[model samples]
Target chain A: MTIHTKTLKQLSQGLQTGEYSSQELTQAYLNRIQQHSTLNSFITVTETQAIAAAKQADALLAAGNAPLLTGIPMAHKDIFCTQGIKTSCGSKMLDNFIAPYNATVVDKFNTAGMISLGKLNMDEFAMGSSNETSFYGSALNPWADSTVPGGSSGGSAAAVAARLIPAATGTDTGGSIRQPAAFCGITGLKPTYGRVSRYGMIAYASSLDQGGPMAQTAEDAALMLQAMAGFDAKDSTSAQQDVPDYSANLNDSLKGLKIGLPKEFFDEGLNSEMATTIETAINEYKKMGAEIVEVSMPHLKLAIPAYYVIAPAECSANLQRMDGVRFGHRCTDPEDLNDLYIRSRGEGFGTEVKRRILVGTYALSAGYYDAYYIKAQKIRRLISEDFAKALETVDVIMGPVTPTPAFGIGEKTADPIEMYLADIYTIAINLAGLPAMSVPAGFIDNKPVGLQIIGNYFAEAKLLNVAHQYQQVTNWHQQTPKGFE
Target chain B: MSLTTDDVNKIAYLARLGINTEDTESYTADLSNMLNLVAQMSSVDTDNVAPMAHPLDTIQRLRPDQVTESNQRDNFQAIAPQVEEGLYLVPKVLD
Candidate 1:
């Protein structure tokens, strides 16, 4: 087997044993990245810096007492600010803006001795579900060239799935990380909100945005989260709770574990074949001594509407910083300050972003604030309460990440509302600020589907344990695309 | 509720985002469709439920009243579109 196909843990062992040098591994991955450029997974390759960093990691390894992740290569989603590197967040607004500092997540990974391959492509301002909104075009799915790789973290998932890099970082706000990870057939964990510091990570929705790890297995995800999860004083909303050792309980038994299957997720909207695949995966859990219980979350259907209002409202406020004054894209020869702000933003933002901003503006306008914004907040409480009540009876919840597998590139882009419904099953977890994961279950017509595992607040360790146990008995997560493999 | 072109224009102005005359009709239709989707929230009765601005419902953390950031105006202003003498230059705001 090629070194690229090995899991992160195995690669770590290889590096520790001197079977392969960090420089060699980094070069191999870089070559793979260049070979697979058709996937359009990366916005910048950072070749020279990556090589230099790998050499430094090699020196640390030679000197002894190096971290387990010392020589492993990975990449970051462009949303995370890396000093001296372009942090576009897949928008024309920030296309020319170079971040002056590193996001806390990037610094943590660098401190762990991991070599960063480069920045991956993503949706414009992390807004779209298909990644077509990116200023840099769509990132095609590795499974089928014609299909999308899911979004805002589309490039992260595609790169990891193709083995261009063993893993990469991703952020989830209304299923950006998990949904793409699902469509690409990988394991992605969205840590409980505030579990990871959001200090320099670009904001889409303040209350719901959380960064986590995407990898080929839950074990690798646990390893990545070990380095990524923690509180930072820089991020006011960061959790003060101590981050537990994520890798410690990865092997814990799932025997007698209560897994709740929300009945609302199985409605007619779900494709029947995909539902069968999910059921089969659940039956495997039943075999492992996990007791399945059907739970009702009646308010779950309202998550899409609630999220549309709340996320856009928060986005409208957060994105006001993009005025041409400080940095980012600016229009030439503006008539006045108002023209600069309007023309610059109008030129910088894409259609989806404009649509969202307009909706948010209307919703927060006078006479409509109480009707839309406040009403969504109240519905948000109900959604959170539903999850809280469900967790009272079950240890975790399981459902399909997307209605079906990856769809064609232009399939749902025509109707924005139709595209929004793609996240119906995954958005509520974010609303509740709970930890969840998308583990590859199986395939439908050569396309991949993910089985989502949801856990209560700060229950990431439990979620990882559940997903790891299933991955042990199934090879779905290990399956790679035909050409990529 | 369907939004008229005037509503779209008003919203664009409120957002400080320019919408081309040609794209106005499409933006109006798209924004109206999104609002129709958002209108579904009215079906849920949330009279007694409290509004949840934050998921964890934790109060904002307060820090000591001290300057934690050092002066890095040069590094920050290096990426500005137009700057002069440590100041960001913009179009004339005064007549």
Candidate 2:
């Protein structure tokens, strides 16, 4: 009766049939969180509050009325503001900050009757590719204790991998969710821009930030997303569209499905181990009656450059709220009005955050605006056009989620370029505003690797079908991390 | 100096960041290195390019302007560094 081994589908059915009360399920997760606390996957565990919510969920079930995610224990990335819970965004600035209102995603989860297992740790302000940027400290991969989980969604991915939570929420600005999901060997998806509301989710880059689901399997990821996606007036950018049944057509056959493998993803920098794993997954799809086409996304090389400029530029503007006079951390010394601003942020944000802020500010500066920020935007359009053209000829794109499997803690923290390179394959989807996913493919060095599946904008159902169909044929997603009984 | 030490100080202040003037020299050095890294964008020609503000080509979704937020100012400002009558207080600037 280990909580980590069971799927959300099974958990939900059990709850619906009165097999286990929400309180029992919440207690089991609380017990597991205590047991695996050494992983540091969670920054805050909502035991008392979660238990209360679970009691309410159970009551609803008993009353013969329950939501789609009724009584299921789930995890949230710390970036989302939870009413009355600590929402640190992995920075010292908000270390003492408790959100007064639930973020849109959190409110949606509550409405769906999902129990909050805990808040997963992440990079400060969702800035870095590695979780090392977190002010609380790094969240290591569950698969290999020494390796780093790709982040700022690292803690969420690690939580699901370690069996602490069945599924968790993750935000992707660049590759925050998918990269971490790949590194930790789980299922993570970043829906098309505007698909998910961002009002409650802390913004890193307004244009790029998207909140989605991360879980052990694609089906679980859909279940998690079902609770999180929708339109809200609070977030003007949220799409005004009906939420689709992501689990619909999930079990559909993959026969004759057109899969495009962008040539750029298989280039020189790809690790041989990851390359082998991805190729094997592609072949598995072929065996399952799918066609693999070699498509070219020539502007692929420009993604990292465009992302660096665009993400940071947007970040520099979005982060202006953390002034000393306002929210979060404020410096103690008050020599003058200026010192309050400098030392407060200097003391508040992490190194990666400061670096990006500095980089972003410079990019948006008057003289450099046209050269750096403006040009990056143009390149972004071309990248999007490339995807649009490719989609016309294909149903989906397959590639390595990351260039390598998750590396060990402190492995690439010092070398920012190396860490940035890890996001090579996944960043393009975000730049294109397309829905993409990372599904556990195979092992590399006994560590998990993910095969990235990308679909056209608003094509999440197709992407989920691709992952679900592969799961029916392969057992990779079923491979649980060690120390799980 | 692509930007002088004083220029760095001015920009930091303008951005609402407190830059320790004593560290201005070092800040200039760090910014110089970063700018050098970002300088790669200058070489690419972008004369005809339309700057992208969003990844999507869809028209900006607009909602009727009205009161959508509830009276959660107390809930929100409760986390502010200094809150008085629903306003975030700061050091006196009119002196």
Q: Which ten residues in a row have the lowest lDDT in candidate 2 chain B?
A: B34-43
Colliding pairs, model 2: A147-A408, A148-A407, A342-B18
- Could you give me the TM-score of model 2 versus the true structure? 0.95
lDDT of 1 by residue, A1-485 (tens): 89988899999999999999999999999999999999999999999999999999999999988999998999999999999999999999999989999999999999999999999999999999988999999998999989999998999999999999999999999999999999999999999999999999999989999999999999999999999999899999999999999989989999999999999999999999999999999999999999999998999989999999999988998889999999999999999999999999999999999988888888899999999989999999999999999999999999999998998999998888999998999999999999999999999999999999999999999999999999999999999899988
Local distance difference test, candidate 1? 0.95
Give the range where candidate 2 chain A is weakest over 10 consecutive residues by summed lDDT: A413-422
Candidate 1 lDDT over B57-92, as tens digits, reads 999999999999999999999999999999999999
Each candidate's TM vs. the true structure? 0.99, 0.95
lDDT of 2 at A155: 96
Q: Local error of candidate 2 at A232, Å? A: 1.7
* lDDT tens digits, residue span A1-485, model 2: 65558899989888999888889988888898899898889999988889988989989999987976899998899999998899999999899888888898998888888989779999989988888899999897888878888799999998888888889999999989999988888899999899988988999998888999998788988888877888877786778778889898899989999999999999998988778889999999999899989899988887887888888888889888888776789988667666677788877876677667877887888797877888888888878888998999999999998888878788887667667767878887888888999999999878888899999888888999899988988888888887865
By DockQ thresholds, what CAPRI class is model 2? medium
